[model samples]
Target chain A: MPVITYRQALNDALAEELERDGNVFLMGEEVAEYNGAYKITEGLWKRFGDKRVIDTPISEAGFIGLGVGAAMMGLRPVMELMFWSFAYVAYDQIINNAGCVRYMSGGLINCPLVIRGPANGGTNVGATHSHTPENFLANTPGLKVVCPATPADAKGLMKAAIRDNDPVCVMENTLLYGDQGEVPEGDYVIPIGVADVKREGTDVSLIAHGRAVLTCLAAAHRLHEEFNISAEVVDLRSIRPLDEQTVLDSVRKTHRAVLVDENKPFCGVSSQIATMIQEHAFDDLDAPVQRVCSLDAPAIYSPALETQQLPTADRIIQKVLAIS
Target chain B: MSVTRAEKPKKTGKNPVDYAKAPINADLTPEQKLGFLADMLRIRRFEQASLKLYQQGKMGGFLHLYIGQESVAVGTLALMGENDHAITAYRDHGHALVVGMSMNECMAELLGKATGCSKGKGGSMHFFAPDKNFWGGHGIVAGQTPLGLGIAFALKYKGLKGCCLTYLGDGAVNQGVFHESLNIAALWDVPVVYIIENNQYSMGTSLARSSAIKSCLAERATGYDMDWDIVNGENLYEVRAKTWDAMQRAHEKCRPAILEIDTYRYYGHSVADANAKKYRKPEEIEFYKQNHDPITLWENRLKEEGIADEAVIKKLDDAAKKEAAASVQFAEDSPFPELESVFDDIYYEVDMGTESGKTGRHFFND
Candidate 1:
């Protein structure tokens, strides 16, 4: 096993996929010469040259739709957005074109496309730049939404997304990009829509995805150390074809659950998880299911306000304690 | 020299050079002329049958008849190679027929039967046949513009010698994505021919009321530094010749260009809006039908040139009607998709198992 940062894992996956398939090309604003706004695509342009590592104009709708069209024409295009929040400008392309093309085409065409970039709040970049759109994208039937919480999962899922015949949205977080974790050396892929139980416990299950998985793990550690309570942390690496059976099995084992998400509470990812648990494992639960989510309001620009608005380890611990 | 705050730039009148005259090239052999006439008549007959079926409650959802805009699709698509691709907005039945989609599959799609081009998933507004290189029948206005550009980008990327012909309505010109697509297409030199089928009215509102610039929609291409030309869409020869030139430029030079085809729609926006009298006068519809019908114009030309006599024209008309009725019968005979199939095709591979377990991929058909 080798340790690598989450950004490096993404870069490695992209580099490997580009090397493996000549048709797989990366395009986005500031991705080529600028080394990406976040530098996740750093040194790829130098490695692959201009044709494969294409730097597009600052037009999300234009380039994303182009990627979908290319995918239809038998080319695998990996398109990047500066931030997932910018996807709003190109929502019609992503939601209408890429998401519905295969179904609309009667399976005659498949958009083997990956639209990846950072998609979380914690950066103090204000409401416009900060958006967790996994819930919104997951709502679309033709799309696969994956949010990996670890470097290994990021690397594996990115490769899987590129290889999949359908369109897959890879939702990354800015805060988690720098976090380092153990990743396998050879060609590996953690399949999408599978949950990883980071910590095993019998008291309660803390289910989360993406960055919220980190908060859940931290909360699980504190629950065991301070309160003598063993909390299970289930990382839902993929959101769309959500691993419902795994979450239900975890809930059935612990008989208590807390759904944690960085997205707002109303009609959010946490809400969906909590509903699933209550619907499937109600009789097995010892207490009511709790949710730790961001406040239902626009993310403020101020550092303190933003920090208070998002979910944290303290919030997950409190939810766990409440249902324990 | 610094200018004062009160010094204002002088306003000038519209430039005369902005109004460039459209090119005219009406040179066609007797065989080619007859082919164009037959193509336009087939679409006309298909649209006529579709209109009748909707009235009899055989189909559900919106039915947009490509009645008057036949030449735009038939002429432009005549230049496409087998490898070339095309995409268009909701006014797409004509384009599908022109791109060689069988009338049986298209009618089945309209009827929501399992044997449709889209397997009963996409209805009239979303018809697609990628095998024929017809990308789709997009519902959202101007939605296919960027997708078309992407297809062209792929053609260039793969080193293919074909262009992507993307069609939009007159109203789609107002959409922001349409402009965005043009800017990128010109910037990257993507091989695409963006054909604006200006069918007089976008839905109910006429082009005069909807468009900001009154003179010509092709002039908008100048802003993006791309070549543009307007064509008499009702004239088969003019439409075909101009589009042929544009498509050649796209294929040979990898240049993106715009072609604004002046055409009209005889019916209302959709079949649902039968009372088109509310928007426009009956005489206006009658005027275009009588004077500017693309099928009639080509038929008269063939007769004048002694290419087709009354009997030959009658035989073609009879064959078109027969084929259209057969398509309707095929649609009515096709069965609906199975209930279990609704969950299929959502993903190419499902059942993605974790690293701890060796769960195999679950393909839909498997």
Candidate 2:
């Protein structure tokens, strides 16, 4: 085991994939000379040269479409969007072309592309710059959306995504990039659509993914330390192929559940998870399922308003206490 | 009485008429001439049958006929190598046919039969044959422009001696993605030829009403610092000549170019819109049908070159009509897909060993 930051894990995955397959290339604005806007692709241009690690103009529709088209021709392209919100500029390319090309082509073509970037709202980057589009992207039938909460999962899921024979969106949080976690040394990959139980408990199950997983884990710890209550934390790393069995089994054991997510409450991931709990493990639940999500409003720019808009550990704790 | 102020001077350089023209390949043989004529006729007949099928309520969804814009697809696609890729807007049946997609598959797709090129999942607007390097029949206006640039990037990335022929309509030139794609294609020198099929209309509105500058769509390439040429799309010889020059630059120099083909569409935008007469007069449609029809133009050229006579032309036309009828039969006879197949091909499967010590693969249904 080796300790590394989440950003390093991502870089390692990209470097390894580019080295492992000549067909795999990385392209995005500022990815080559600027070392990536977030510095996730630092030093990769020097290692792989200009052909593999490409710098593109600030045109999301142009580059993303290029990735989709290239993927149709049997080349694997890893495209990066500076901000997930900017995906609106290329929404047709992602949703219509990248997502449906395979199914539309009757499987004659496979868009083996990985579009990865930060997609969280808590950095005070305002409404346009911040977005958690997992719900929007996951709603698409042909796309696989993965949101990793740790360094190990980030590295493993990114590698899996690049190798997967379909378009996959890797949603990374800017806040979690510098966080350190234990990652395996080399040649390790964690399969997408698998849930990991960070802490086992019997009182209630706190289920989450991405940055919200960290919030759930903190709330679970607080519940145990403050009230002598046990809580199970389930991390759903993949959004599309949701590991429903793991979620149901955890809820059945705990008999109480709280779904935490950073996205808005209306039709968000937490709403979906709460529905799953009520549908599958309703009889086993000791209390009604609770959902802790961001308030139903566009993300405000003020620091206090932004914090109030997002879900926090206190909110999760409050939801668990009320349900339990 | 009112007095008017002096008018400001009109700006220059907005429209450049002195565009470059490519010479026709001098040694085009009789065999090539006949082949070109046959390809154009096949497209014309196929579209004619497709229109009739839609009218008979056999085919559903939007039916966009490439009735008059045959030579643009036939001439441009004729020059592509086996590995070269192509993508276009919704008016795509002609391009698909010229790229070697079977008339039966194209008709089946238009009829929404499971035996279609896209397995019937995608209707007329989504035809694709990746095996043959035909990318798609995208429905969105100007949506295929960026995808075309991406295909060109792939060709360059793989060091392939092939270019991507991305076709858009005159109306698509106004889209932001089209400008962005052209800029990047030139900056990166991606091997792509941006072909604007100037059929004079974007759906119901004419190009003059929709576009700000309507004279030379190829001149827009100047902003991207790219080479561009305009050709008479109705004449197969001019289209082939100009496209050959563009493809040569793409393959040999790894450069991108824009080609504007002056063409027309005889029918309404789609079969559902029978009000084509509301936008453009019937007389104008008849004029293009009689004077600028690509199929008739090519047929006349073949006869004038002493390569094909009236009998030979009649034989080719009869064969095309017969093939179009057979394609309809193929589409009508083909069965709809199984109910379970709705979940198939959504996501390709990959084996991922499970935590329970069993091998499992990820797919749509499972």
Candidate 3:
């Protein structure tokens, strides 16, 4: 095993997949020579050549649909959205064709395409560039939404996403891309829809994803050391085919649950998990389910406002300490 | 600077500027012309049955029948190969029939039966037969134009000689995505043929009531660095010949072309508005019926060619009616899916040892 950044792990996974199969290629804005704006696809164009590592002219809907059409043929394409916001232009393709084509056509046609991008707010990019889209994408069925919180998980989950015969939205976060972790070398795949327990405990179940998972983990450590809350941290790797049993089991043991989300509070992942818990594990809960979430406001460029709008490590700790 | 000379024009009475160079021979076999007429009559008969069903209260929802636009797809798509892809707006039954969908399936779809083209899931505006490469019966006005360009790009990437025929309303030409797709098509030289089915309304608004630009809409083609032509939709031969003229160039040159087919709708927008006269004159409708009926024009051509006589035409019409009836019966007999199927077909799991991708799966279990 080699230690690598989360972004490098994604790049390495892409490069390995490209090297393994000549039919697989990459396409997006700045995915070639310039690597990627996030440099996750660095040195791929030089290694794979222009035919495989394509540089598209900033047409998200056109090129994304082009990838879908190509995937319908024989080629496997990894389409990169420069940012999560670019999806607004082509949500119809993702929602209507990429996701629903297989089920709607009764399995005659499958859209085997992967759309990977950096989602969730942390780097102080305001408003349009800095909103978490877990709920927006999760609301639509027939698409797999995977958000990796670590380097090894990023590599393994991306390979699994690319190899699977369905459309997947792999969301990486700006804050987690630089974090380093041990990744098993060469040809590894993580199962989709399976949540992993990062820190085990017996008091409260803290469910989170993407960047919010990091905050929850930090809060879990603080709870154990300072307040003895014994919080169990669950990083929900996949959003759409969410692992319900693992979450409910954790809640069943802990007797309370809190969902740490990076998006606004109104209709975020907190609501979905809370509703599911209510439906499945109502009698097990000793206290009402709590949610540590960002306020209903845009992430303004001002660091102060962004800090206010985003879920912080301090906030997660406070939520756990107060309830404990 | 280049000479920048315009093509010569011919005198044809009303705004007659004829564009022809060298010699033009728009000829097909008499049998083939009859085949096209047979195709159009299939659409006419099926839609007529659909109108009948609507009257009986068997059909519901927005039913936009393609009563007068038969020649546009019949003429144009007849020139295309089976690999060539096509997409169009919700007023799409005619194109679906001409492209290869059976009258039975279409009629069943209009009736919202399980045996419909989309397996009864997508009704009316969302039919897709990928094997046939009939991309969609898209309902979102201009949404398919850019997607059509992307499909054409895929054809180029695979080195396949496939062409994309994307049709839109004259009203949809105003969408920003249309202009964006045009510029990209021009820039990349994507093999696409954009046909504007100009029936002079965006849901009830007329062209004059809406626009300041008063020229043959094809004139906008110059801005996109594309070759374009306009045709009388009533003349199937002219519509066919002109669309092929543009489509063939797109194929050979790998560049996009636009063709505007100036047509009229015999009925109102939907079946419910059959009596709509606030927007159109009754006399104007009658004039078009008498002069510019696309089906009648083809019927006359077939008689002139002496390839199909009245008995043959009658047989064809009778066969269309029978086939449509059989399809309705099939749909009625077909059962809707079980309740659990609603959650199925969502994600694709890797099944091993098939013709699809394999060999690396089944490695993990805990």
Candidate 4:
């Protein structure tokens, strides 16, 4: 098994899927020649050629809808959105058509399209490029949203999305692209709606996803070494079809739960999970569900303000200690 | 990409209704002309009943009346075949009825009934039937244009022989998607028929207020390197004649065509405003209904062509109304869809794309 960075994993998955399915192709601005702004699609243009790896005009709504109509005719398309903030431009197509078509058409048509690109804060891409859409998308019933902090998950999801007959929004954090991990060599698939327990303990359970999942894992180590508090860390991989059983199972054993997310405090994905614990497993909890999240402010270009807007490892460790 | 119209050599005779004036052939026969007029009447009556329901609150949302603009949809839709696709603006009940959706299904959609085209979830402004290749009763002013070309591209890629007719109001011409789709369609020769249903009003606004150029939407075709034609929509014969020429040329040349049909709106923007009548003048409304009545002209032509007598024409008219009434009754008798089906049809399957997340399917129970 070759160890690949998260970025290469995404690229390999895209290339392999293109090679796997003739009907699947990649199209977006700079996706072909520029190898994606994040280099997640490097060298794909040369391999797939212009027809399969298309470089479109900076018209997201137009191209997104084109993907939709093409998908209705059995073409699976993977579109690289420039940034998470710029998603507003394709809101009409994404919110109205790509996401809504399957339900609106009542199963007659399946929009097997994928929207993939950078999400969350990294290298100060500014407020426009940085966005955490877990809450905005989690509420939408027609869409399935997932953000992977590791490359293996990114590669596995993109390929799976291409094969599935639905429109998927794969939120890729630009910061996570450099992450290197052991990835299976051949056609290996990672099952969705399953959580990976990075650290095992009994005192408390830390539930987190995306970039925050790593923070929680690091926080778990600090609590074990310094505070002598044992904490189990769970990477809540899928945000939409949340693994309630895994979450509750950990909480049931630990008697406490700590949720973390890079999204803002109000109505964040962590807030939803906290609510779920209270609603589904209220009697099993010993302490109230604790959450570590960013301040409720639009991401600014200033590095300090930007850093202040994200959930830090220290904050996750402090939250875990407080609940302990 | 412009056309000179080779229809003049076909015939030279009296206009069907008037024996004194000689008619010049322009790609349409008197019988075809009559057909366009009857088609317009069908849309007119179909939407007229829709407006009545809107008044009674049986129909929901903005019920756009095609009372004065019947000729435009009737004219263009008459030019389509089995494979051609049409995507239109919110002013779309007329388009749906003329595109061959049952009067009941279209009206039931208006009434928000289960038997409606969208099973009542789409209401009036979102009816779509892929089987018939009609993409919408889309509510957004200019949203459907690009999607229309998308469907055209799908057809082209599938190697199906047909062009896509994307219709929008004068208001929609200002949108970026309209221009985006137009530019790409022209660049690729995507076999699309871009029709601007310039009904003189985009809701309450006039063409002079909205568009920089008031003459013809087809004139914009030159900038995109595409061909264009302007027709008097109220004159169904002229509309039919022009549409026939454009559709054939679009197919044969493997290019895009823009047809600007200049028509009028007799009622207010929606059902609530119809009685108010503050936006338009009585004389302007009276003129289109009296001089340019598509239905009356077609009936007169049917008599002149000796196709049928007065009784036969009346029978067709009565049967159309009866058909509409029966469908409306069917919709009224039907029940609303159950609420539990709301979570159905989200996707094909969860495990298929099981890498990132598990997706559930949400289908027809809506």
TM-score of each: 0.94, 0.94, 0.91, 0.90
Q: Compared with the true structure, what per-residue lDDT tens digits does model 4 show for residues A1-324? A: 788899999999999998988888898878999888788789999988976898777877777777776776677888888886777777777777777666665545667778888778756767777788767876666666777877778777667667766677888887888999888888865555566777898999999888888888888888888999999988877776567778888999999998888888788888888887888788998888998887777777788777767878788788777777
DockQ for candidate 3, C-alpha atoms: 0.38
Clashes of 1: 0
Query: What is candidate 3's lDDT per residue for A243-305, written digit by digit as tens?
Result: 788899999999988889987788887788888888889999988888988877777788877
DockQ of each: 0.49, 0.58, 0.38, 0.40
Q: Chain B of model 4: TM-score?
A: 0.84
Evaluated on chain B only, candidate 2 has a TM-score of 0.89
Best by DockQ: 2
Superposed on the true chain A, the predicted chain A of model 3 yields a TM-score of 0.97
Q: Rank the candidates by lDDT, best first.
A: 2, 1, 3, 4
lDDT measured at residue B90 in model 2 versus the true structure, 0 to 100: 91
Q: Which stretches of candidate 3 lie over 4 Å from their true place?
A: A103-107, B1-27, B209-212, B272-276, B350-366
Cα lDDT tens digits for candidate 3, B1-366: 011225312212122422212123234666777788888888888788777888888777777878878888888877778558887777888888888888667766666666677656666666667777777776666767776886787777777786898899888887766776787788778888899998887677888865556445666678888877777777666676677667677778788888888887887788787456778898987987787788887777678767777898898888878877777677667666556555555555632233222322212111
Model 1 chain A poorest 10 in a row by lDDT: A101-110
- Give the C-alpha miss distance for residue B267 in model 2, angstroms: 0.3
Model 2 per-residue lDDT tens digits across residues A1-324:
789999999999999999999999999989998999999999999999998999998999988998988888789999999888889999999999999988888888778899999999889988888789999998898888999999999999999889877798999999999999999988878777888898899999999999999988898889999988899999999888778888889999999999989888889988778877777788998999988888888888999889878889999999888977
Which of 1 and 2 is ahead in DockQ?
2
Chain A TM-score, cand. 4: 0.96
Tens digits of lDDT, candidate 1, A1-324: 899999999999999999999999999999999999999999999999999998988889888989989998889999999999999999999999998877777777777899999999988989999999998998888888899999999999999889887789999998998999999987878777678898899999989999889888888888889999999999988887677888999999999998899999888988878877777888999999998889889988899888978888888888777776
